[model samples]
Target: MKTTITPRVRTLVLLFLAVVGMLFAGAGTASAHAALTGSDPSSGVVVNKAPTQVSLTFSEKVATNNDSLRVLDPKGKRVDVGKPSNISGTTYATQIRSGLPDGTYTVAWQVVSADSHPVGGAFTFSIGSPSKTTVSAAAEQDVGGGLVGGLYGFGRYMSYAGFIVMVGGAAFVLACWQRGAGVRALQRLVVSGWVSLTAATLWLLLLRGSYTTSGKFGDIFDLNLLGQVLQTKTGASLVSRLLLLAAAALFIAVLFGAYDKREDEEKRDLTFGLAIGGGVVAAGLAASWALSEHASTGLQPGIAMPVDVVHLLAVAAWLGGLTALLVSLYRAPADNPVGRATVQRFSRLAFGSVVALVATGIYQSWRQLGSWSAFTDTGYGQLLLVKIGLVALLVGIASISRRWTGRLADSDTDTAKAETVVEETAAAEEHEPEKEHVTASAKTGGSSAASGDPKRAAQLARQQVAVDTTRQKRLRDADPNLFGLRRSVLAEAAVAVVVLAVTTALTTTEPGRTEEDAKAAKASSSSSSSSSSGALTLDMSFDTGGKDGKGIIRVDIDPARVGGNEMHVYVQRPNGRAFDVPEVKVAFTLAAKKIGPLPVTPDRITTGHWAANGIQIPMAGDWKISVTVRTSDIDQTTVDKNAQIG
Candidate 1:
């Protein structure tokens, strides 16, 4: 005889099949955003002579065109001879024209990272000496500001949400609860997931083009920009995601279509094939995201990438199945046997998914944050910690749901027992009259009791029926643990949404390892500072008026003891208020070495502040500095001060 399958045993089988399917399906490479690792003539460095070229090195290979790198002189003019060229795979270099004058020059660079995300920044370097030029390079603006960034993050969250709902919901319907196959709400959820992912991917592509090029909202639909974006890795990944979504939709339709009309045995074979196909598509879609995110560009990507795919699948399964289970609870009756079975099966599946999620999460954390301090020091690490905390909270809520599930099982058993007793009592009542009449005769005298027995038997039969009705009613009214379970599951799903949002933000953030490396580099450079690169600040007073004419002149020289120095002059009136002069110039003279009158014209910054760049201090000596302030072009006064240069 063929053995009948029990609900509990079937649940276990389905869980096993789901886990196996995910493991086999999630095997693909991952990618991440790039970071700058090092640069020649580091920011704020004082060099004895100007270098012929400027080079910027990144942690990954970069893609660039003509406008990728720019070098600006103290006067804010482009000094780079030509377009930047990629050197040795990772470095981008731009040549400087010969006869470049000594002064502070700013390098502004922008390039597409290996993952096809554009990254740019600006830094300054001094040649011969730092100048008081007020024309500093403009800082790169954040793409589209907070609103755009938030929209991008929202798109990512929606994509994640949709993936979980569609994939996990389909898996739940096929593997765990076939009854849900026809549920309109569950089917809608799957469709909604597909739509969300597709729409979000398209939206992100447009946003990314604008983001990378710093274009305005009007440029979002520009064909040239769109084509350029499509050529990039990120764009290709997004396109692949859409293709996978289409394939998934067809496969889901086939699976459901087969189930809607097939016999039980046929459904088994069809669902098995669907599972295999769906798993492949799911993994491919996940890989598309990983190929353009932090996992791909991060440390040990060979290991981290596949791990991320597993992590994503696990999350989708647990959270997505939770949503399906909640829907089942809402639509099905409180004592619905199918609903109870679904809850139980999903609970088991979720437990396994949580285990996978935790394991993969720990590994990813280790890969992203190599040291303990990074957890406290880096934004990425801190955000990860927040996500972990939320996951733990979700687990706690799930535990409550599990407890309620156990109670539901007990409730089901009691209800079943009561139902069985009702059936047996009803069957025995069919022959009750004869048995009752005989017992009545035995209790009294035979013929006298039989004459009145008919009326009494009818009355007793009515009373018996009343008692049975009451018993059945009480049993039916007992609670089935549905309300509590529904509430808990809802809470769990809410927190899961929050976790997804945080995860989306995490992908955009810089990894802790990169941040730590940058810090270490900064520290090393600062430690190598010497007297030639020392900074100094000085104060002097100029008598511009006859009697009470006392204007304070404050000079700030960065790397004051070196070949190149930046001079910032601040003038204040006799009443300690800022003094605005039309033209403020500084003339330097080295008397001991017989160097005389190196007049420097500084750009006027604001009313009381003046800056001069490329103030070349030829050698180490005592230099006399004269500050000339032209109050009205006619009314001018000079102040003298001495500075020791090394």
Candidate 2:
């Protein structure tokens, strides 16, 4: 029982821990907060007129503190929609002042959610015109796919899978890495899991530069922005704290491992200490996920850091343990029967690991998604289904490997028995060397023995050759079964890759709606009463106010439309030359809408003129004009932008 760590084992341990670290650090980068699932106004809604306010609802409850939503008009300008608010008191909302005229507008949002992950998006909607600004409700922007997107996706997959692996792996390895493993392995596992956790902290700090810049491979040293990001919650500051905690756990484990290493096998009292430490670390990491999403808020304390930390550590223990076992199996010096014994022991551990993984996965999903209907109703549910399917595949592969393991182990017994029999027979044949070697006297058995009993000698030589061959050969029958084990392990690895791919995809897709809009329009369709359209022919875009020559204008809009009424706008100069008024385009925005050419575009886009270009200024006062911005079949938004002839 040498205390010195062997270089090979040390290398194996280091590599295994590094993988765990990558898994953890990457877990928060690309995932969570239930995705957009579905929005109240949806991404792009054209209305007959403006609504009272704009709302965005996700599959889960989200934050609405500080910043959340942004509304932009066609000219790429930010329209002060309103202070962000939560629609269901769950997601975000922004009250747009009522009189905005039709055109195209964009709604951009970012938030941290209960899962403690950042999510953001931009969508378009046109007034009067058919605007389907939604890119793909089910399509998630993933990490490694594009800058921040990929990080989020990667982090998500890691968070979920890492929990199962790290937790289960820790338990498995703990029970088997040593005799008194619940305690002994727990301490080491903590240390092992922490190194990467620390590395992730540093890497995340470095990663914020990617956020400040447009893409990956950008300047890693943007000092001022870097410092700012570290200071900000969405950036390095938060991740750093997680890393520091993970580091602390690691240092504690190292001390624990050192102390335990000195204790006798008879006095292995590591379990109590290890369990207490593990419980604390688990609490810390799980809390981290609650604050990880972009949809989170101080108002809803549940969705912030705590849940995230828990999800992360649980996943790490489960997946991290699996990863460790895989490595241990791969590098094990199990050259003979004894080594195979260790393999058998791990196979049993793996069986238990799989069971624990399933239970935990179910628990976590339920806690996050809420209902079975959400599985298909929300975009997040759909992607989750895909990941689940992949997990099923992984299970199938594991089953195959298990079957092969049994066969291979059984073959070893048969092969050993046959070899023993051959050795016994060979020993008996050796007892009669003189008889077996007959031919001639020992003195004459040299060069010219052929002159004596050549035929007899030839028979003896053949027997000896056959006996030697049998002893040397490990029944060719055993080889195929042995190789089968290799195939099974390879298949598991392949399935594991598929799980990663599927999970990555899940990180991007929307969780979808908890309950889809049930409203059906008799002539037109919309889901909600407040969200429904009126019989109003209200042109979606009509301008009311703007200085004769000034580019900047303070325009207001009513967010809700009245029943059966048309909204109008008038844009004119103080001199009153409304003739040939071409090249006029009105761009509108609301939380529920997008930016595009108003459907009422009579004026060509080439000329930058609207449909009402140069008609006439009937009077010097405000004139009513119509602009069309069609969002849905019935939930259309008609906005009014105002301008007056001075």
Candidate 3:
């Protein structure tokens, strides 16, 4: 028989599908927390002599090896010597070959962040003088994108979805409604959860290697790559999850098979055992995430990891349980409807889950945010706000469901009293004497039926139909309240789906506290480097009104004060590679003091560099500095800026 779905159910189904679509739509946009704070022989600078080693500093500790850092020459060839070394927890250095050529070079790095996410980037530095480079920054830093990243992110969401559903559904059956163990619909739901989790876990295991490096789809199935993945922390977590799922399979069997057939006391004993075992398995599954994700590496990891586990379990119990309850309400057989007691029991469990959620959520927010400003300042904090809002909406819908449950309970109690009264009156009437006319009719009918009387059979059928009609009417009277409760629960489940999706994204985002910390570290390092160097550097861009005339000019001055100073200039093409320019001129003027535009003649020292020695600044004041460059004989442009000679 074909069954029609209610309008509410149809809407909820559509909303859930939309949420799932959104999950995959933006899943590959995960962020990393280990930011590059500083690097030696920094980007776009010219050094007269190439340094023996290139060093990098990060805001947080990261895991790196020889392959993590690569130094490539202007021609895109590896130039680094021996293995790269981790100079410190937050610093890494690599030795480069001696007597390197005078040209630009690229340094590309990829490392596992403190939060266990892979991040990579590239930069360029010049030796002696900048030169045209064939290396492209975009091509060198393709560490986290393409098909592999998308698939890995999809696997992550699926794993979370499966674990929540399986754990929550089993908890509902074992704790709130044991009779649900025998329901085929609940059985299928929990089994689907197991299947999803197992499949996603395997998919993740296969993709982890490629997802962390190169982000190539072809490398996903490479056994060597897979073995490399097995040695990492995330790999260990995935393995643990699979082992726990094995135990989960046994738990599901006991719940539906042996427990369903047990007597009352035996059922109770089995339920107690299942609850304990399930709790262990669920916590273990949650730990697999807690020990590998953001919680394990950030501030106060000892407390954060355990709290994260609580948060995951609480979420599963509340959101997952809602799915199981929703299925039971709409799909249970007419003869075995979800009872008022079952609804009340789940209501209590949901309340406790919400309490745990709030407590753990508060601690996590404090840990990740570290301050109030992050709520408005950072992406992680903003997403956290969205989740909190959705959770509140879910709770509101849940309260409405509770009210409907209370109403259903009251209506059922009244129905029970009415049924009892009807039964007692029927019992009293059983003892009453029958009329002589009725007694004669019955005796005649009995005789006709024994002789094969169709008329008597028809009369008996009509009497039985009258009894069935009264019972159906009684059931119809109670359905309005049941339907109301179902609608509210459906709303709760719909909102919970959005909450879960936001949560998945939140876990992948860089926390606000870490972002702020990185920014502070970068600023401090920049300030220290500037003070120690005691040199003024300025960059300007010029378009010389010719084909390919636009380029950047970097001007450097030592002790740029009211005295003689050496000035050097470097020019780079629009592509950021250094190139030679024809006919360059520089002049300075103290316009406020009406000083002459004193010219400092520059002579070519290298292919893309020029030097002017002992240029004098007559006074300590704002001076207009003008630079002119001619790409061709007729094509030239002059750029001007003010400099403070202190």
Candidate 4:
């Protein structure tokens, strides 16, 4: 069978693979993802006695330092049991020191997962040994042990693994797989894609029940679990697309293999076509998982979806393709000319693929890094960096193979042998010109010969031994080529393992969430428990567009009278911090004491919050104010004030 294995075809295939492979490799190196597993004093379980400690379990390891779990008894009482630790490789436990005695107790815990996700959950436990007790909603809300804490932990790990594999696999194809060569490359891709697709299906099925029940059995026919996973806002969109792509890859695979019976060349082309098709499918699945995780975290779906999708597709190709390349080389038929051609083609393509991977990876790193501290302080970012390091190492290895290693030279073995012989001959000839070198070597040898005390003959022998030792040492230090291929392969594989582990970490983390948590805490503290100005219930009332055609202000100060008109009121800023104002100067549009000697007074009601009783409003519209307070310790300041009067 005639095969048109043109250089152009190989180049084209390599170009295509390179772009996609790098992207996939970049996406698989993050790990900071931890979700809640199960908690003790289980949800909806009414206990007669107050348990001493509240315990929770996680699917993976958790950082022991700076992470905590607390259980609050009824009436907002702190009843946390004990210190939380990762006793087992996978489980994290915390003891409840003070015994819990309550109508309902809530266990609110926050901790760092193996991947660095600070996962938290709350559950309620009842106390007081009684004959019969029932778990009620009121009791649940008081301490509200959430239903999802433990189950989410397991789901999180599973999803993390799935994403890393899918992304890593795609990266492998993009960065490592050779196009227009290797009859089996395509078959391997197809096989991998089919397996992942099948796994997704099974996972969704189990997820259907787990979503509803927190966790599910690890078996087939988990229709209920599958249904729930399929029903979720993000899950439905992601899983549906993956399934479609998987089916398509299978069809492409059949077409490729079908031509194998007709001709040998046909089989080679089929292999190339099939591999490309499989990479596409694998990329699709990787993207689905990446985007879905972003969506789950409540980010704007519009931005998160595309950023993550693109990120995953690129990563999957690089990692998956690389793996495929490694596997092919390990098992390829040594004598097959076609296979050898494919290997060479793949090596060429890998360079380009790595470039693309770096570009996309940089973009992703910038987006998810959020802050510089995340690189060193956050678990997720560290894992991602490790992955990147491994990738760089892998690229280094590839470069050596392609450029420095004799394998890629046009006349590899011959060139190496020639170079070695020439070098040896030059060394022998240079013994005289390098007189100082030879003389020094001879002196060292003479000293050693003295220990033997065998006259001039032994001294000469010692000189030769010294020279040989120096040469051998230099060779060992400067040349790795002397080592067998097996050593090189082992070194590369060791590096690969480190990279894979980092990829696992990145999969679990929610890109970046540490910044978000801080912002959220600040917001919760500042925002009003309800509306502050809506349907004013307090004594103070302000009218906008009032009688004077300006702002009118009213002050209904509710405070225990101090000296003149002292009132203590809590002043809160929008960001949830206490604020103070000096002597207030009120006016219609703006506030200044220049126009009139404004009669206003500002005093600290409680240490921070400032208040004014019977403050005057000059105009009718929405009156604005500037309260200025003077003090010895701190300089006096004025703050913007607003009041509406009818």
**Each model's TM-score?**
0.66, 0.50, 0.72, 0.47
Across 171-221, the per-residue lDDT of candidate 2 in tens digits comes to 544444542232433444444445545544555566554532333546456
| Candidate 4 C-alpha lDDT tens digits along 512-627 | 44333333323322221222333111211111111111111223333212123233344332122333433333222433333333445545556445555654444433334333
How close to the true structure is residue 404 of candidate 4, measured as C-alpha lDDT?
Answer: 35
User: What TM-score number comes out for model 4?
Assistant: 0.47
Can you tell me which runs of candidate 4 are displaced by over 4 Å?
Answer: 1-120, 123-193, 211-213, 216-225, 245-252, 259-283, 295-304, 337-341, 404-406, 409-490, 514-646
Candidates' C-alpha lDDT: 0.71, 0.46, 0.79, 0.45
Candidate number of the best TM-score: 3
State candidate 3's TM-score.
0.72
Provide C-alpha RMSD values for all models, in order: 19.1, 17.1, 14.8, 18.9
Ranking by lDDT: 3, 1, 2, 4
lDDT (Cα, tens digit) per residue for candidate 3, span 476-561: 33457777887788788888878887888787788886676555434433432131265766665565645556566667778787
Q: What clash pairs does model 3 have?
A: none
For model 1, the stretches where C-alpha displacement exceeds 4 angstroms are 1-34, 47-50, 115-117, 132-137, 143-146, 332-338, 409-480, 526-528, 532-646
